[model samples]
Structures are given as structure tokens and as C-alpha cells.
Target: MSVAARIAGPDLHETSVAPRSRSRMLALVIALAFAAVGGQLVRLAWQNEDASTIRVSMMSSPANTLARPDIVDRNGRLLATDVQMPSLYADPLLIQDADEAAERLVRLFPQIDVRELRQSLADKSRRFVWVRRGLSPAMAQRVHNLGIPGLLFVDEIRRTYPAGRLGGHILGRVDIDNRGTGGIERYIDEIGASEAAVGARLSARAPVRLSLDLGVMHALDEELAGAMVRYEAAGAAGLVMDVLTGEVVASVSRPGVDPAVYEDALDPSRIDRIAAGTYELGSIMKLVTVAMALEMGRSLDSMVDTAEPLKAGRFTIEDLHPLGRPMSVSEVFIHSSNVGAGQLALSAGAATQKAFLQKLGLWSALKTEVSSGPAPQKPQQIGRIEQITLSFGHGLATTPLQFAAASAALMNGGTRVTPTFMALDGEAPVVRGERVVSARTSALLREVMRRNVTDPAGTGRRADVPGFEVGGKTGTAEMAAKGGYRKKSVLASFIGTFPSSEPRYVTLILLFEPKGQDVTGGEITAGRNAAPTTARIIERIAPLLGVPAKSL
Candidate 1:
């Protein structure tokens, strides 16, 4: 201080103020100016900072998109669930070198077009752009390591199927925003399950429980898949249902689709055959015809002549192995005689046949939680030919699901049963529908069905599980084509009920276009393939269904 005062002249220091006071004031003014200049520089730096290094949250981006709830089987087994995943996005305004960023990203994702991405990133008007969606954790980490500017990640919920393709047609699929699009997934949305939930967080509601038993479903799936390979069949479909409650415990269609793969569901060849398509069910329709005969005061032992082939215009209806004698009604069912069934239909008249079919619910479409199947294709009028063919499962096409529902009613003691996919909650009583037949008629039908499995010459003899007492009908019909029926191609199917004395469950197995095999005695009949397949399925699923194997 003394040196500074000496250097400054004494006259200058003493003129207006003390040297120490003036020096302090000057230092304070300088400090204030520097502080203002430092703040401006810091502000400019922040505005120009590299956005790639910064993390931007898109929490409120898809605010209206609500997460879906878990879909579980009857035993609380997981089928479908929501999982948190990081989806990639970009802020175009923050992208400094758009060309460089796009080029780097294209290397990681070969599917992305670099030029299109470049244009998207170069547009400063849009603050956000989608880079990629539904990225796996490993995939997200790989993209993060690239260190591209403007690229960011947002947490979102995506639907995941745990069992892969199992129950795909039943569980359905979701959209990009996690909204239900088809199957039971869409049913959830229709019931307002996601109405109140409008965020990325998953639905807090208790999981949706289906009537399907995972163990039984797996058994059915495996058996059907094996059947397809064993029989050299083009496709296969099967279902197991609780006859009393009308609950479809298991439904599977081969060449099964995966819910995660949207394209698979859209494929026509991969459609759910159980409930999605209608087919001329061949001999299975005789179940309805025989039920009509029983309901019309005809005894099981009543004889109907099948000595001559049925002639209708240009068509001649006959049995594959005609007995060439007057056959009893019970024999008519056991043999699956087309001429016999046609006679029963003619005796009852065409009007009676149509009414019985309509009463059985086979004359219309059957809508389940899975799908509203195409309406049954039937003749416009019930002429002699139409009535004869309809009686023996031709000139009329209905879904296997609809036919199953009708059969369940017959097996469940005369009461109508509407097939359902939803589980009956709690100790809810099994509400029975209107009686479609007399209890006496139901008992007679049961007696004959039992004979069909036990009798040596029965068409369904191959379908008998040792202790399950399976009774069913076999069908092998030439597949219909543009002009007429395809001679060699057939839809082989068997529909049976277990513990036939008092039926509990109904099983329907279908094998489409099965080829002749040595094990089948070089025959492509339902008894050779579909019947034995049904037997195998019954043996496997009966234990899971709580239907204990009875002592032979």
C-alpha cells in the first residue's frame, strides 16, 4: 500500500477522497461487471449444449395409451403380461449432424433407410420422431452405446406372451399402443377393463381368468400336433369342453398362430379352425339326426330299411359298407349309414329336419369370446336332396365349435348349453338352459353312444380309452369344391363324450386331408386317424380334468 501511494502523487490522492476508499469502490464496480458478463456466457453455452449428452424424459408423450392387464389361465398360470421396455425416439431440433447420426443408426439397424432417417432428423419443425419401437433390453443397450446425438429412450409397456403360441387364438393380440385388437384381448377392452387406466403403468385390476386349464390345453395342443404329423394331415383342430357348464377347457388349431406375431393371425391358412371356419362335419351330424329320431317317438330298436340306395335326381346316396338289410335305429347310429339317416329324415319330413337343426342351434353362426364364426352355409330350401344330405352332414356347413355346443347340450341331459370361454367365478351355480329334449330321450341317446364305443364293430371303437368309456361318431366326407366334391380329399373327424354313461366332457378332433397310412390299413377314414387321436387325447387329459380312471 505504501508503494502504491508513493507511485500515485500525493496531490492526486488528496484532491476529492481518500485513496483506499476510492480504490475499494473501483474494485466493487469491476466485480459487478464481470459477474454480469459471466452469466451471459453461461446462458449462451447452455443453449448450444450437445443434446446427445442430455437425457430427455417422454413420460407424458403417450398419455392416453393405457397398459393392458395380465391374462391368466384357470389355475392362475400366466398367458400374457405387460413388461417395461425402452423404446427409441429422437429430437430433431437437437440433432446437429443429421446425416452422421442417420448413417450411424443405419449400421445398427439394416432395416432402416438412411436417407429417410436423414430427412426426418433434419426437420427442425418436429421436436420428436420415432426411431424404433419395442426394443429389447439388449437391443436398447446396443443402441445406447452408439452415442448418437438427439437419440433418446422412453419407458413403455409392451404385451408379451409367455407360453408363446399356446392359446394364441383365444388370448388374441394387441396394437402398437398396447390396445387389445382381437380375441379375448379385445373382449377385455369391450368390457371397459382399461377405461379408467390411461397411462404407461399397467392395469392394476386383477388378472383376467379364462375357463381354459393350461395343463389340459397343453395336452390337447401336443396331441393334435403329433396327430398332424402321424396322419400326414394338412391341418388339425380340437377342443375339450365341460358338458355341464359349457366351458371350453381347451381349444387348439394346428398350424397354430402366435399372438406376438400379427401377420400369423392375418394369414387365412393359419386361421382358428375350431371356431373361425365352417365345414361339412360328415357323420357327426348323425348325432343330431338320431336325436331327432329319438325325440319323434322312435325307439332305438325300431327298424328302418336301408336295402336300396337313395336316389335323388342325379345323385345316388349309399353307405360305404352297406349292410343291405333292414337296420335298427341303434344300428343306424353305430354304422353311420347315410341311406339310413336319409330315410329317418324323409320319415320325419324335410320340415321336421330343419326345425330340429334350428332348435339345436346349428342353423346359425356361433359367437364365442374368440370369434363370431362365419354363418353356417346351408341350402336355401330343404328339398329331398338337401334334407338327405343335411341329415348325413352335407349341403350344410357349421363350425366345429357350434357343433360342439350342440353336442354338449345333448350330453348334459337335454338342457341347452351356450359355450363360454370365461371362467365361472366362485361357487356360482351352473345355470341350466331350456330343455331341448326329454330326459328320457337324453338317457336313450346316452345308452346308444355307450354301445358305439363298447361294441366291436362300432365306428368309434378306436376312440375308446381303456377306463374313460369314450363314445363318439366318425365322419369321412369328401371335401366340397367349386363344381362338386373332391373325390379323394376328405375331412376326417370324431366327436365323443367321456364316461358315456353320464357324460361330463365332450371332445371333438378333426384331421383335414389325412393321407392313407399303413397303420390306418391304407384308409383315410376318421376311425383310423381322428378316432385314435381322440383316444390318445382322452387318456392324457382325463387325469388333468379330475375324471379319475375307473377300474375296467
Candidate 2:
């Protein structure tokens, strides 16, 4: 009886243990299944986060674009902005007939090279290939209607110029990948104002505010365009700069490049003339000569014998409109007497003349947010002939921008003025550059400039705007050829300052290779073309610049 009971008890215990083990195994399997599912979900979440924070290296791929800050004028008018645009792409591996696709695409865009696209699509190894970037909605829809397999669209940020060609030279262009190429666009890159983006994410940073006054810019462009037609000029350029702050309020070059069309900017003939081209600026340089004399302890009444032409080597320096008499320092400036300027420069000698030019920032390269101005082309040797030619601005060639900066210093109470395309943070920093001339000398120069325009016989009389008290000097410089200067193809320029009593803005107007026209009285001189053009510009832009007109 005992043996049988023991055997039965062992069997029951074994059965109970087997059922418990099975239950434990089932629980472990369920736990492992849930763990695997939970891990999969976590991995998917991690992948999404990684995608969102992915950093694209722009240097590695040209297709990787940048997110740039908005560019706005001082008045908050939009100049340039990044807009979302649809871009066409192809999965080369999935494309069935590359040749057919290329042919169809060419029908939609005549600009697309069929052969090149066919080659790009034939590369089945490439997963993605760009067909076209920045397509308009209509073009995108047409491509979509084709229902071509493997053709896809991706949203991309594209640079857009809302002002059209108004401030094109200053606003600059971006490449196909939205990278800054020139002008203030390059400055934005240098200042870390742009972000590299993998996709179509927009920039959320504050807009970059420029010193340009849109109203004034448009006014200047209109005036220059009209002058180009009125004077029959090959080209024209104009700029307005704050005399005290060095801020360039408005700048324009006719035959301007539209920033939206990058190809136009690449054209050599459409380059920015204000800062990119250098020229012998002619008689306007007499202002520098006069300033040098004043700094050398000569007063406005100081007289220079200008009765004869100045001879240096084989070159003779004579006034275009000679007074044929001894000229006072004031008269020399007003008359733009090349003979008197040469004599004054001879008195100062070469070293002093160069020093004065350097101090006025006319002898070196100038840089602003828009560009590093083309370096000044100074005479290699400052000998007698060189000095004479330089006195009237022929031997030394400089960009109009550099010349305008020097003129600004002369009118801003003897303090040096630097030109800038970006707006000042607040009040302009007090100019700390070394004083080039005495305040008294600056005032005297102002008086002479005013007289040059106010006098009925003054060359710049045509530049005068009533109530605005405009004053300026005229310059006509022949373009330098392979060996010498062209006789007829001259660069006519006029630099004007307003309200001579208290100067604010300085304007520079230039006409390149102008021809005789009825409006210009059949003359190509600066007084006939550039001076009157400046007058028109001032009349329109003065009110926009907030310059109050004096009561008649």
C-alpha cells in the first residue's frame, strides 16, 4: 500500500511542475515579442530625429543649398528673399527610356540641352539626378502632366529679387544652389548670416537691412536711365553717399544686371561700374589739388601763376577753358585750371601729393559690404610729368567709388569718410581717420564748390538745383586706349554736394562715351551732360533723401 501511494504522488508532482514550466515559457515568449516591437518603434523614432537634424555639407554637393537671411532696404522694402520653388529631379535607376525622357523635357524647356540630360539620365547607378532647378509652377505642372515614370519634384529655396533691377549691383546674385556669388550677397556669407540646408527649410533670422533708400535708388536709376537716352551715352552710373556717415544711400549703373538672371551679371559689359571700374576722372581731381594746397598752409586767396601752359617733359598741361591770367587758389578750383593745378602740385612736390591722396583714401583699395573696390591704379612714378597729369586726374586711375569717398572727406568738415553699403547700427561712429586738411580749408572748398555752381559762368551751373543749394565740379576724362587716351570716347563725371552751408549727401554722376545730342547742346563735356544729369537726379532724389528744400 505505501509503495503504490508514493509512485502516484511523484507522478502528480511531475505533472504539476510540467504545467508551471509551460506557463513560464509562454510568459517569456510574450515579453520577448513586446520587447522586439517596442525596440522597432524606438528605432523608427530615432531615425526620424536623425533625419530632421541632418547637417548637409555644402562643399560636398552643389545641389545642397543655403538658407539666407532676407535682404531689405533701409525703409524695410524687400529687395531679395528666398522663396520656395519646385525643382525637378530624376531617379536614373528607375527611368525606363532615358532618350525619350530627354526629348520630352526639351519640348518643355528649350534651354535644357537634350544630349546632356540624356547622358545624366543614362547613369543608372545614380539614384538621383537633377533635371532642372527652380521651375515655375506652370512649367512644373507641364512636366507632371507628362506622367513620366521616375520623374519627381522636390521643393527648394530659390533667391528672388523683388525690386527687379533697382539695386541689382548692390543686392548681388546667388548661384544655382543659392550660394552668395557677389555684392552684399557675398558679405552675407562672410558674416555667417546664411545657413546650409539639406532641403527647403526657410531661414528664420532677422532680415539684413541695407543703407540703400529704395525711393532714392529708384529715383537715381530713373534719372540715369533718362540721361543715358537724353545724352546718347553708351552707359551711365550714379551714387549718393552720406557725407558724414559714409553710408551709400543710393547707387545705380545703367545697363544694370538683374540679380535674378545670374547670366546677366556674368556679362562683362554689365558689370558694376561704381566700384568695379577705374577711370581717369579728369578735372574733378582739381579738388584734391586744391585740398593739398590748403593743407600745405595756403589760403583761398593764394595766387598761382597760370598765364602759360605747364610743360613737363613732352606733355603740356593746359586748362580746357583757360583763364589766360594768374588764378587765385579759389579761382583755380572754380575754373578747374589744369595749369594752375599742375603748378600747385609742383609746389607740394610728389611725396606731399601722394601723401595727401593716401590720406584721402584715393591711393588704395576700398572695401564696403557690396565689394572690395577695384584697387586704384596709381602712377608708378611720381615725376614732374606724372604729377602734372595727376593734378588734373589722368596719370592715376581710380574707381568712381574711390573718388567719391575722397570728395566726401573734403566736404564733411575735413574728416575722412568711408563709403558703406550697409546701414549703420545707430548714429554713425565718429570718423577717426587722420584729418587731411583744416576745417577752415574744408569750409573754403565748400564755398568754392558752391560758387562753381552758383556763378552764372560756372562750368557746373547746369548742375545747380534751386533751393537745394547744389554745388559740384565737372570732369571729362578721355578713355585710355592701347597706348594713349581716346580723343572722343571720354568719361564725363560730376560730383555734387547739397546745402553747402551744412553738407549732408554727396552725389556722383558719370556718363561714359557720350555723344553730342540736342538736349546736351551738341556737346559731350561733363558740364553739358553729367552736370545737367546731376541736376535732374538731385531734383528727384533730394525729397526722397529727406533733404529740405530752402525757401526761395
Of the candidates shown, which would achieve the greatest lDDT relative to the real structure?
1
Whole-model alpha-carbon lDDT for candidate 1: 0.89
Per-candidate clash tally: 0, 0
lDDT accuracy of residue 294 in candidate 2: 88
Q: Please, what are the lDDT tens digits per residue for candidate 1 over residues 1-552?
A: 545655676766464566577788789999999999999899778875554333232335545565677889999999999888888999999999999999889888898988999999999999999998888999999888988878999877889999999999889899988888999999989887764333457778889899999999999999998998998999999999999899999999989999999899989999899988899999989989999999999999999989999999999998999999999999999999999999999999988899989988999888887777689999999999998999999989999999999999888899999988989874988899999988878888888888888899998899988888888998898899999999789999999998898899999999999999989999999989999999999999999989978898
Candidate 2: which stretches are off by over 4 Å?
Answer: 1-63, 427-433
Question: In model 1, what is the error at residue 527, expressed in angstroms?
Answer: 0.5
lDDT, each prediction: 0.89, 0.88
What's the TM-score of each model vs. the native? 0.88, 0.88
CA lDDT for candidate 2? 0.88
Task: Residues 228-346, candidate 2: write the lDDT tens digits.
Answer: 88878899999999998888999898899999986888899998889888888999999889889988889889899999999888877777788788999988888788899999999
